[model samples]
Target: MHAWMSEASLDRADNRRKVPEWVSAQWRRPGARLLLVDSDGQVATDETGSGPAGVPTSGNYNAQLHTFLGLVDGIPWFTTEGPIIGPSASLRHLGAVTGGAALELTVGAVALTAWHRLEPHCSGCGARTRATAGGLTRRCPVCGRVQFPRTDPAVIVAVIDPDDRILLGRQSSWDPGRMSVLAGFVDAGESLEQAVHREVFEESGVRLREVRYFGSQPWPFPRSLMVGFVADSVSAELTIDRDEIEEAAWFTRADLAADLAEGRVIMPGKASIAHRLITAWQGRLLG
Candidate 1:
């Protein structure tokens, strides 16, 4: 798994049929801390510290701002619905998450914010939706329709051939000779395994088999889950789809090392699952 997607120690208590009653009674709990964040998942902190120890939830927010982000270590956490409010909070972006308990909190907050931002109307009848399940659900009063947040799934794979060479490709938008594994969105009614084979073949014209699961990552730039895999190619024939891939190649470990040493090939960033998957395979397969 990519370091950013590693598990953080948080108990969201998602199975609770109703919002915790304690959310309404947190003020009486002497040690309770209600985390406050704006639409961007940024939390206000004490001017002196990096931690969100001084976030004020009352000065500029009300009940409407609340997005109950389940319990963390028995203390309640809440995210606000308006513009980003924190001056000192950290921002976790694609491929960059300094894992701590707070990273999960930030990801959860941001995912919810995206749900609220992107979906305002019920899909069933086009009625304006309102929060009903402590912001976990958006319900329509006019049509009795309910909506939930969406997390789009995608597949990313590294293809290998009989000689143990890795298959990598470059897209038109990338810098020259910069190559990474092939990836694409999983289409409707398609299994993940099917998506992997379909995407790899579609982009590079390579037949793949022995598709195996590698790892997963949450790329929440907007909202995407990157599923990783490693597969073996049935043959090594180049049929580049100029519209999709600019170039494709098979690389032995030495080929990769030479290009990397000469600054001809740039690997994916460390924060990505692609980098991790490639690194893992290189360590196990390299002579």
Candidate 2:
């Protein structure tokens, strides 16, 4: 399972968030904590660099700069943007070292911070929006339209052939040794299964049959939800789409293991759904 899907430790308290008094009370409660995130989606980490460097939610914090991040163990948690005096790390690195609620909280904090930062205006009308409902929503005064956080859906799949070989591809922008499973964003008026077939064929000319849902991951790299799937390929053919994929190929388990051991190929990191999907197919973690 993805790191963000850990056992629940934070209660979002969606119903109570509607009450301004309650949200304010959560902010002022003892043990209230604040997490700081930069525009690049990196958060300040503790001295150990294993967890977020959270400070007390004190002083007169501007409501626009911070939002409620739910509760951990009945203690309120808030997220804000600001400068800090310590080491900072991206969710990619943090996801590797942290797990459970700590990782979940950090992911939530980063996603919320990015949403509030990028979406401060109304999409319907050209009007500025104000943070409301403890930062879960924004309300435009001119149009009176409320906007919720946006999450774009994308699909990532592992294509297995009749011979039990998995297909992987390398994007042109990546290093020579880097490769991973095929993935693309879902289009309008399209279903998840359609997306898997289209993306696979477009990238590698591999027709798919019997596509099955695997799982999902909250890929908050600028707010995206990655839906994972596994599909059987009709045939193994090399038809690389140089536009997005620089090269494509099918590899058996033995070939993949040898390439990985010899430093000839690099798989996705543990932080991504692609990594999890590939690991599941490979029957073990990739080196």
Candidate 3:
């Protein structure tokens, strides 16, 4: 599993939060570290360094450079619009090479940055918003309304038939032969299990039962919280919705191995929860 999929050593005390100035003071403490992410979502990492590399600098905050991410092991960790001191790497690569420290900061920063970029005004009053709560929130000066970072909850389910075959689907827009589990966003008043059932039925004309949670991951490519599940297939029919899915099919472990070797099917990247779910059901990791 990707380390970044899980939480890190940081303690995000959102309930008993510190003020901005207090958070900044942690930067001056010895052994403090700074991390940064580009506008495109890559973490600033040294190409030659081992294990979640980060930029090296004294603990000083540059207003335009750093966004206070949170406390890492009780010390300040910041992200920046960096002219990073060194080369940078993608979060996917970082996951294979490192632990949660760098990955957590990068993901949090990217989420924060996305919110700031996408929301600049209060929805309630059209007032300009400013960073508050140690960069964890945005406040409207006039209405005093506060906005925090938001993650859209989406359910990604690995559906299985009584025969134990796994169901996978491919979107029309995906790369050739790429396949993944069925997924959809939770609707206005629906539960996660309801979304799973509805999405599966709508996309493939299949019904599912026993919707059980598997795990979750932070997929912050423009901010989404991927809630994972495993569901037993009640209907084996394959009726692909042309609007959403181009293809839907069932595969056994042996079939997956053959397709993987022949390059007939491309699995999800290791950085994604889909990959872990697939490997888990197969009773082994893909080599």
> Which candidate achieves the best TM-score against the true structure?
2
lDDT of each: 0.71, 0.86, 0.76
2 versus 3: better lDDT goes to: 2
- TM of each candidate vs. truth: 0.82, 0.95, 0.90
Q: Which residue segments of model 2 deviate by more than 4 Å?
A: 1-7, 284-287
- Candidate 1 ranges with C-alpha deviation above 4 Å: 1-8, 26-56, 59-63, 81-97, 175-177, 285-287
1-287: candidate 1 lDDT, tens digit per residue: 22644555666656551453544454335454555555555555555434444243343323344666666677666665454343545443322434455656666676776678778898989988887555677889899988878878999998988888898889999998788989999999999999999999999899986898887877665688899988988998868888988888999889998999999999987667778777877887422
lDDT of 2 at 277: 84
Model 3 quality (TM-score): 0.90
Clashing pairs in 2: none
Q: Which ten residues in a row have the lowest lDDT in candidate 1?
A: 54-63
lDDT score, candidate 1, position 170: 91
- Which stretch of 10 consecutive residues in model 3 shows the poorest summed lDDT? 48-57
Runs of candidate 3 exceeding 4 Å displacement: 3-7, 15-17, 49-52, 56-65, 83-85, 284-287
* lDDT by residue (tens digit), candidate 3, 125-228: 99888877666777888999998788899999999988888999999999999999989899989999899999999998888878888888888878899999
